[model samples]
Target: MASQPLDPGNSGRNDPALLRLPSTVRHRIYLFLGVARWDGCPLLFDLDGPVSPSDQVTFYGLLLSCRAVYTEVSALLFSSNRFVIHYRNKRSLQPLRNLTPPSLAALTSLKVVLNQASCHHRREAEASGACCTRVSGCFTRKPKGAGGHCLIRRPHKNLHDTPLQSSDPSARLMLEEWRATAVYLSSNTKLDALELSLVCDVDQKEVEAAEHVVAPLLLFPKLKDCHVRLCISPNSHLRQLARNASRQASSNPALEPASPTSGSSRLLITLPREVRIRILEYTDLVAPLKEVMWNRLGLGYHYFSSGCSAWEGVPCLPPYHHGCQYRDCHGQGIIKDGIVRSDQLRSIGCFCGVRHAAFSSTCKCWAPPTPLFLICWDLCEDARFVFFSANRFVVSDSLVSANPWLAYDVSFTPDPKWLLENRSNYSWMEWYRQAQPPRAYPAHRFAATKFLREVVPADYLGYLRFLELVFPPYNHECWPHDGHPALQDWIDTVDWVKDKINAPAITLRLVMAGSRMWHPACPDDRGGLTRVQGIAVLTGYNRILKPLAVLREHGLTRFYADFAWPWKWTNRVYERLRAADDPNTILSWLEGQETLLNDRAERLILGEDQHDRLRSNEAKPGPSPWKMHSGREY
Candidate 1:
């Protein structure tokens, strides 16, 4: 069957009724025609294949109705759907490179999947002059080793027998093509999202080649979201690069004009208080405030090397016997025959632990509206309240370690000259070995109250309505001891929150490890468990939960605690406790079971509520309530 020609004569002239409709209605029709919407599915276009007959009629047919319609709707066709270009070989990317300037500029979302096998195939084809015979302009001239005919190709038992080389002409050509396409996309398009997937054999050279090919595409300036998947180990570097590009894109000044207050928008103050608050809600001010990890690299390095004792011959005299106030070194008795250390003993800086925080939401579709807070005093107050009260503020164990007073101790700064002169034989590692705390000591202690008291401002704390504290998994052995520092820390934290903060609802989460039952009867261990082990496990959990039960009287209207134990183990534990003979054990088991069931019910209810909210938002029409600075609608 033959396809109809685009822009057939007199088609639009005959359709007077369609031309009489409003421009907005016509645009809506064009959008529907260009990308038909099916529930819960994304619009995707594969440029690697030919256009389907249905698309030719419903999409291109509409465009060909008239020159005016084609001019108006062509851009929408590229912008509305996500185009997927699979680069299998050099010829695979021709469709993308052939896009006109107008089409490229309108492109907003793209996904590119790179395959390395095509390069190998091309190389093999070139070796035997198989591709040369297919070239239209090629002259039939036999070369030295041709035997008066194109060389016959031999099949390899293993396709990857010949490894791809960086200097190979086919590989170089493919990379050059990729770089050009990336440059064009970056320069011509203001993309909302870009996804790159590298599919290749898990070899070092192939991974390097894939990285070089995708390097330029990762720098799309106006992208709001960027996703990169490398089918190889050690992809963290590439992932970090993509993250940096996304951050730069969001912060790009060209994405939006100056603050709304810069112009006559100063008149916005005349709006009603309710209206102003509603407007501010649309901005990032209402987004959740998250505690982000700070000084990650420095802390990671220090943590991994904390036990290193490279600095030997370090001695403690008089007050220095207990070591420096910063606790960088612990004084060990002198050994006479050790070499003097050259490096100065320095304290880890104040920014070692978590010291910086930000208002960050999980949504990557839009950047936060930060300038709104700087507009005026009244607006700032409103924005702060909206931010604190409307969305939950999350605190974790890392935030608890951000005590600047403890971090910066000036009582003891090591004197380099004195240390070198009075050098001891003891190495720093030996001192660390002696000073290191017991393994039983908890690595992370629950300190939500301490974090709020030390880091958050009193004004912001009072405005908070919802607070979520994520604690590290409770250690049964460390937490059961009443005199332990970990136990004391937990008590002090909850006590302080009860005394000071007035958040209406508090959510406590403990991420736990999954447990497995070991069968004593079977030679090959399976799921069945002995009664004694089960009882011990349940008792340990009970002891861990006993202290947290105090949260019920913390004065909050609602308090929810989630012990994220696997359902299989939780049910097994409950059954084991139920079979026990003691009445006290039965009562405790009932209480724990009730809590678990209630948590499950609450989760289902919350999920349904979220679903309802989404449906309501969808029914309301217009753009999403969340304000997007990029001028793109979700």
Candidate 2:
């Protein structure tokens, strides 16, 4: 046979032009070519195969280019991507054991899958009918009497046969390997996130054994997010182990007293109290505390804007649109698309809009100073004081409406539909009942109210200087109505605040929107307020303010009600009312506006001529001034 020609793949290794580039430049080139992109999925590794099934074909050519090329890019391949290894047997972890020290040190994220096969050696030993004598609930293979056979014991009842101290030689070896692997990972790897998933058919005893096997890995000090999943039960001993590890790691340095004669701790202690506090402030310890409904990883704030508007003639577009509140506004879309179509103006209607912006917690501009609180007891106290006293905590209507048990309970597995809705990444209005179903609010059990009551420490409540409670826009049919559960929940929350927070300046804000009218074709596409619907707005406004009376009680005079209606002229009216120090001014202004709104409603209902005249004027408009410069779009 003729000798095989040299492989083109191998030939690339000697390419002089590519090899001449600097290592940094070559690394970027490899990354640009998609060598490091895993698209949020973990990179799978299996000891049985040279590479994972998903990547073997794709990376084969590049990796086989030459040993030199592999040496340069292997670090990037291992470090930049998250690696997951599945443990099936004693040798299942060979892939991890094979990684070089440098490659192991560069790892940022890792996940390990432990399954029933991990205990195969123990199962096999039991199947072979090995004889043993029980001593203190543990089975040993040595005979009790000379020349006498030991009695066989059932493996299921042998709870002491944990992987770590198993009678079976293979089982003990496997545990040793696991311990060694855990030691290597904890000492060498720089993991930010680690997950240990035990998806095995296991009883309580087996579960405990599995926990022992993974305990060391759970104690990795540098992890920011550590998750342990036990398929047999909702709770896991390993989960508690992970928590203890996290707590110990965070407090270890501070637990031991620093030498008074030397080190930075002494220098820190020497500084004046004011100077230390000033330095802490610069560390962003005073970030706002806000509530989030989904993927809430740590303490941080999210920003969102909401508004309502009324449109004349045929409504311009959908009632709800998600984008920049001003630039891509649905109301503006009507004007941009030309309000006058086929010599007719769109009918008048109401629009309610809300848009979610970026969350500050995930932004890389600054790291959370929560770790600073764990540095020392004195620092922790100072951090908490600055965090609660200097920043505003906002409790929104959506937070109150959410089912806290479902959202906050790690053990509770929500319905598939609920999970899909939250994970879909759709732009949704948190306050809208149509988008987010409201939980039946119980006075003492409401999620938001309960969080304020029980979750926040009592001492921190005293430190609070500013608190903002935001209620959804008033709906005549629902809000402040007799026996409304949500209304009761709100009242109970205010009562709790009054009782607990004595000195904090409270801001009560009501979001207002024009009444919505559904389009003839699409039920979900709603229009802005009509003349008749405007009456409901006035009635709703009057009813909503009745709840604010609870805030006017003794020691609660620091509170003020803000009616945040987004309409230009309406906003100015509310702004002027807000400028007054007395609550009586707001009530008086609402009374006057209610009377004027009622009069307009009556004329529009009874007089056809006024409706025609209003429509005629709307038909003459080029761009509705209200839509152009709404008080604050979003």
Candidate 3:
């Protein structure tokens, strides 16, 4: 084969030159490269780890090697819109002072991921080599992490050394340096999107530093996009999510520009169609999803907890009519609206308020509607190639070349087809069929249908396409999570779906403690499903007739009923419904017989018991006989 071309466009596989190509050709080249990624922009560099000053300079120099290559690569590298920076040593902070151009201009999106694990371990020991036995009093001690990461020790703010201690002179100096460089980058760089991951080993202050230092610059500029990922690790407190949120500058008139994050529709509903689809794909993002992962070994119906565990105990909420209002129980609140605490033995609800809603807990009562609820607040128009939570599907195309302007196709549809395609990647059988006996925790599963309906009207193609665009965190074009927990949930719900109902599964369910109460369940259980005494369906004007039906004729009951407690364990509330009503009084509700049936009942079954009364006196034949003797002799 010809030296496989790294340069995308042109004749077969040949080592394409990195320099001196006509601008049009290069642009077109990128456009036609590998399965149409961002219109063929292939400068994807996964530099999501610790960076030495050398690494930063190297990446910068490598991109700026020659103006021709530099022009194309510079934007892609910085346009990444996401970044992670792990500082192994305090000295590593020096790179922020040397950010190059184009990269700086296109650096609208940024995410700084840090390792906050074991970030507080400290010891009282002197640097042996630096210490003189003759003068023990003069030598101060140095701290070390098992992996060689050092912690600056101090006394004022903490008894045990922590990265938060302001007493350490060196730590304070490092903090100051971070602010200085961040200010400089802000003064010079123009970024649209930004994210920061706070791993263990780093203090909330590190994240606070980014908010204080970086936000002033990035948030002020007239930009279009802004993203921030506040990742809290195991050894770290989760308070930082709220802390960073507090740094939001919605009214800073000095820097407040009219754009997405600035109180205006940042990623507008009318973003390019591609972006719209992407939004749908990633609308359900849940980072730090390990706790929410119910099953990731590819074998069974996994239970997701922690970050991705939004539906835990969420009741069977319909897609339309009802708006979402997550309320915590007595002490533990519903973990919706971006709350992640599956391990704390709490409860959840997944109830909703609409007919034809993809999911429904009770269609008895009517509730106000809201936008399609997304755990992650920021969503974009690229639902096809990103997963807000996790990918249920992963498709790879080899046709993508590089072209910043070229357009590509990504799927972010709420259409069942897209959902099915998104689901094909999972092994639902892992624990699906073999799952232990159904156990009800004190959680409730409400419907999200009302929410979906509020956000998406019944405009068919328009709504479906809209879902594709508004949803973010999906990967239909390229790059998807290897083992997507959300995708796993999708498969579990789908596979468990009785093939006969082929009706789209409406409710999203999550696992939690047995004592906790979700919506229908109690709302005050911090100990999960175990705390709830019982669950009651909401009586809404909504009712389930048939998933497939005309708009008006659908059987809707508007079910809504609050519980009185002291009854019922954790079993599905839907099973309690015996029938729509008495089967004998069918004729009273039906008109002169050719009724447009839009429910789950068969006509023959309903009519069988009813007396057709005063029928034409034709002698009826006997019922068809059993064919026991028709086969061979016994």
Candidate 4:
């Protein structure tokens, strides 16, 4: 039964003469009858009928009207794409293989047993549709990993069963069938999209097994859309491993996850960087307003690291072997003639902001929050006569100019010898320019850069002070001013491995810096960027200025402490580290704080694995997030 959109009078239900029409006219009439309908409507399924209480009998009679009518309508009658399966526990989803249209008969028991789960409309469905069933609010829920709710339960749950193992195998068996059916449909060539639920654990073995299970089908050539809800226990080795994998995937688009976990309320599992970026690119990321991506734009790493001619000029890498040859040119590797994919473009556009922020990197590096102002300067100096077509700054201008109500400070000024430098000095850009778009940021960019140069340096700093006043640099605040606060981006810290392959530390810095929208008003969705590890939005100037403007200023001014591992304590940790065996390992174990950079700086300077090994029988960090409560979460 479909929700009726037309009145019985207007829908032409009164005319018995409609039944006297020829078969072709009748079929066409039926097609037009169910415009925009998705329910169990007779016309929608291509069957001519006055559907009623005797639906099965009515449909069968229509099927016997004639061979021609039955043939055309029958094809559509069985074309329902949705299927449900259920199983008891996580297993190789092989039972699903039999559900192929050819093998669907093998799972006949599925239909009989799980009929209650069918989405068929009910007389009271609309009336019973209640909101805010969960007391955690409709949006939040307490499930396993993050700790279960000892509090009252949510009444209106999207998932019918519980997150924990069910006591009754009846429910478990039904769940197993559903999972198997999903796996079966996934391998189907015509499946445009899919949805599935699975359990994830913090155990390393679980992560490996999960990957192994999906490895064969994950490589599907036509598979462009995927949705998965997988949750695992907290502090599980698998969770950390997944987090690291996501971080590593910042440059790899092919590996992103398809969907948020069940409640969509809580994360079921940790996703790798590329996958996380993919989700961010598609999701409505509105909270934790202080995220670097919202403020600094360059955090869109995938765009820069890609070889799209539109972004060829920005420096970054695709995901690839740490020491692979040609690591600089093709991070993960590129194929000729591929334009910047929408995913990459959105990410780049999001950072540097399609309007105001511009590309600014030392050519090969990424990260450390560079103030929006400095990145503008880097673009001004790079190339003077660039075309305004390929870059986002132009698009942003168009958007802003159209909306006069949006507050902005985009006016720029040009430098006297803007084009004289010729971009010959930068190491990565100089060599990579052969592959980049021949255009630069244009003379107009200089104006914005210039304005930022004269006006923003202090004002923007004032904004930081305002945030400090309003938000307070609680756990970690003011990145690029120093290493970072606890839980900083993996990008700010360099992948010593990549540097080891590209060049040396000689004044080069790979530091974490909070990022924000380059053009705050721009609406495009670009995922986070950081070529070295997943999820980094980059800025050419930030790469240059973080050390120069932000950190240098902080170190030179000795402004204050209270940043990533704070400047003073960072030194003490290193001193303690020097005395420990397997210092890096010991440092990893230190739980009290979740500082993001101390390890990278040490790795960059001390050389990889050069630090003393700290022998702690227990491999863990002190003051870990599990114990110390710090920072606000949305």
Candidate 5:
């Protein structure tokens, strides 16, 4: 075989002088000769044998040109490019098995594309020693017999004449063959990534079953990366049937057809730009100062919540209408046990009757919507710019000690019950401790903040219109013990934010939580100052609001008095003040004002009758009733 003359094109390439060139030149020439396709391009090794050598020549032509060239380039050919194997039957393994050790050693990544329809037919041919007679076009109409009878076409020889199994076999045999081949390949090569794709007809049920069997085999521990994709043929009968059903249904006037734009439209690129924006606006993408996650893994539903305990009891609310005002909650207040607590504060009323037991329990805590970025690059680009520009990203006070971006690095909190013995100690103080403290400790917040400022790309923040700094609620322990330290850290963070903002004109939201009213004072509480002590509440407000007023003086505009006990009253009294207004004005006015704290303290000092008389005199009217049938007021 070595002495014989090679094929026409193979003859001229057999020059011994080629080896005399510099190694670099030789490697470059070899690269051109060996690479069937560009790097990363799929070099498909069709399992169905080519009818002619010409098809094989397209991929392996240069290798057969000369011995020296083949020796030099084969390794580069295998290693530099990705190899794809199109599998149909047992015969698909032939090329992989035939690979020389050197070629196998050069291999780094392999992708296998399996066609279930072909595999099914191949299996049928193997079992019956022929193609299924029942299938249309399996036999030709041409007659070759003496009596002019039609003749049946013989099955391909590669299948080997064997009886097909009557039942659809679990992918065991197929998987076993693949496993053996995978083990052999692993032994021979330094494989980096293994990808397996299943292409099947539109029987979703059967495709899933086939995928379940074939997918796990791709996950060889030795492979550094693994991916499995399922592609259903457009010609799938099930899809055609579904389309037909939809057409038939649309023809019937009584059957109301759902609007095409009712849900998230997958063909966003195809839609007009305005339509896309309209659709995206409804998503959290455009929500202001709210945490939005795209492609989240938990809940599998659509909802939002202000971070609160999932297990907290529902608040008692008065009559409400879809478009009712915030003060629509009847003059009633938050009723705990049977006792009506202090008159319903607007801050508490904001969350009154709001429940998220279904979503919060399942959601991962503070997880970023990373999957949003995983879609097509164009869509990701469009969405990110729009999202960052439209909404103000908030780094709560706890997160301000460090960069906010770092928060995305933390995973969602798992169910405490799932932790078994590792769960937090739920003791006497646990309720009080958990209630006032930040859900995520400072360290996690710091990491998240760091990630936001440093890790998130500058372009994403280029159009940032707003940034919110939420002052975490202070419990009694947080206030007296750690208040100064927390306040100092927050002030430093505000300074950093002022200097770092990228936008020309950005609004800052300074959110103050109603820490005084966060925990209702318990009667069983002993000699320690009440959770809402007069001096402690006064000092905490002075500590928080003083710095906040400074930031406002420096031009931070949106002061969100979040969860303030008298949300309505507090907003009316304090939020309405000018940007440069003095913090002490409100502080001095509040000092003498009758509030829940003063009422509770006064009740203790005086008797119940005195407080009751005061409460009755100041009682607000209940929500207005619905109009009567005659259109007259009740």
Candidate 6:
């Protein structure tokens, strides 16, 4: 450690020892200096070209120290942080205009902030007492001699004097400003992320305006993440915009099939059509595409039957229930003057100690696929024919009229009527609100229904060859028994198919969701009994053949009652049965259950407990005979 220190030029050496280092070591130093220069420099650049002495010292001070440092650090600066482009006014763009192509090209991320109000408007607000309005906590008084506007938009008199303005600033004034900046920034093909923040009013139109400004950026080549944030101060509006923007941004697919001329085009297009078909055949969809529709939109399960624990809506008691004349109803139920409030009815627990899972007989009516199918046009069609045509789509009578989209053809285009109706409809608004973010499709201008209407092609719906209509339990007396509109949506769909294609081209499957074997032992008055009966009514082939016949009259070629239990529940039930029953008995029962719906369709609907009871000698002969009525005999 005590040896003499080596000297370069000072010791009469020809060249400096530092410069004599390896090229790799030199490059590393260049990188280090490039990053370190920031420590010496102020993070905030001074307005009007960084005139402050410290600002100059931070960037140029080190750069001027040597030519080599300048060359390396200059490029590093552009690639490191996002290039923030703030437009105070027309003349404020001078700094940007002077940026060289190389400097602009080095940038990676861009943030464009557009102030809703112009400098002139801001100045006028300052002059008028209205600008200082403290009534709603929106405006704050500027301290004397301090900066008058936001840190991002400081008071510069020359900024207001600039005469440049967009022709339609009132409507799309921000677009011109965006266009100018976009033209310059887009040249940098390396740009990955872009964020647009709009300082604007908190109103309905604000979202539309922000969307208009942000939509153009999504198509930017190499762009991965794009966000549009609102600038409303209270954050209510800002939060909503963020929720919607994130939802939309997350749904964007990373890769799409390329056109014929693109690089990926050869990879897919060169393959034979039969090979592509064969490839798709290997992929299987376990559940209907509707099961994962929420997943596609980046959300979780939202489907819940009415009056279920998961349903979201106001709850009220039956009209006949006198205000609980007695707090005597256990647990001091919502009672006023010893009478329970009808409104507190939903709080009542069932015999099972859980809330009613579905609408009860006497209670107030409770209101209740993988993305790979979309890979390419050809693949999608092939998969559709194989899956949709082969398997049955399950629908419910209760849901047909619940959603207007199901009842009628929906157009996704930004139609004026659809906007006005959806905006005003309370049900639509409530549903759309719950779907925000993680629960459903991130809230957007168009709800899931509207978005679907816009994106799904007309032809896509046409070729679906098989469909199943499943009705929910119909035994709830208190539930709103809205007359099944004779104007069934499926009938309309069938009619449309008849006009487009040959008769009997489509197969319609009608199904009840549960087995009827348990219904006889179940008490009719119990809510559980009603739930089983709902599916029991659809178990027999004769029960559904009438509706199927009507649908066939319209256009369907084949009609069948599919009494299959939901597979998800089936797997769970089977696991429990396997643990208790002999393996051979369970296997035989399973084989019989598998074909219960498909084997002649008129067999008794057997419940999981029926077989178990029969094997265990717990079975009792039922009054209701398992009589098979033959349709052929009729």
Residue 433 error, candidate 4, Å: 65
User: Top TM-score: which candidate number?
Assistant: 2
Model 4 misplaced stretches (Cα beyond 4 Å): 1-84, 88-141, 144-188, 191-205, 212-221, 232-464, 468-634
The Cα local distance difference test for each model comes to 0.41, 0.41, 0.27, 0.26, 0.38, 0.35
After superposition of all CA atoms, the RMSD between model 2 and the true structure is 19.3
Candidate 5 ranges beyond 4 A from true positions: 1-279, 284-371, 376-378, 391-468, 480-489, 499-507, 515-555, 562-634
Cα lDDT tens digits for candidate 1, 203-265: 333546645754674556646544343322223344333334334545333222325755534
How do the residues 1-634 of candidate 2 rate in per-residue lDDT, one tens digit apiece?
Answer: 9754443443465465555566656767776666665343223343345333444435546667776676666767766655555565334578777877776766655555443311111222232211133211122123333233333433333222222223446555566666777777677656543333222222334445555554664556655444333222223343333334433333222222222233564566568777777777755565422212211221233222211122344433443222123321212323423331221211111111111111111111222344566767776777777766665555444322221111111113355686578776522232222332222222323334654666567667767665554443332233344466655765676666666665425432232322112111011211343445445545545554454455445344333333323121244444665687885777666556644553343233324454445445533212112222223221
lDDT for position 61 in model 6? 62
Q: Please give, for residues 521-548, the per-residue lDDT of candidate 5 as tens digits.
A: 2111212444355355445545554443
Ranking by TM-score: 2, 1, 6, 5, 3, 4
What C-alpha lDDT, on a 0 to 100 scale, does residue 632 get in candidate 5? 16
- lDDT of each residue in 529-631, candidate 6, tens digit only: 3435434433332333332333334444344444433231234445656585566676556546645644344222222343344336633221110011100
Clashing pairs in 2: 313-346, 313-347, 313-348, 314-346, 314-347, 349-528, 349-529, 350-527, 350-528, 350-529
Q: Which segments of model 1 are wrong by more than 4 Å?
A: 1-261, 268-275, 287-377, 393-442, 447-451, 470-480, 503-557, 560-592, 596-634
The digit string of per-residue lDDT tens for model 3 on 417-459 reads: 6447757653433222222321221112111222232322232
- Candidate 3 has an lDDT of 0.27
Query: Clashes in each model (backbone N, CA, C under 3 Å)?
Result: 2, 10, 181, 90, 18, 11
Cα RMSD (Å) between model 4 and the true structure? 25.6
Residue 309 error, candidate 1, Å: 50
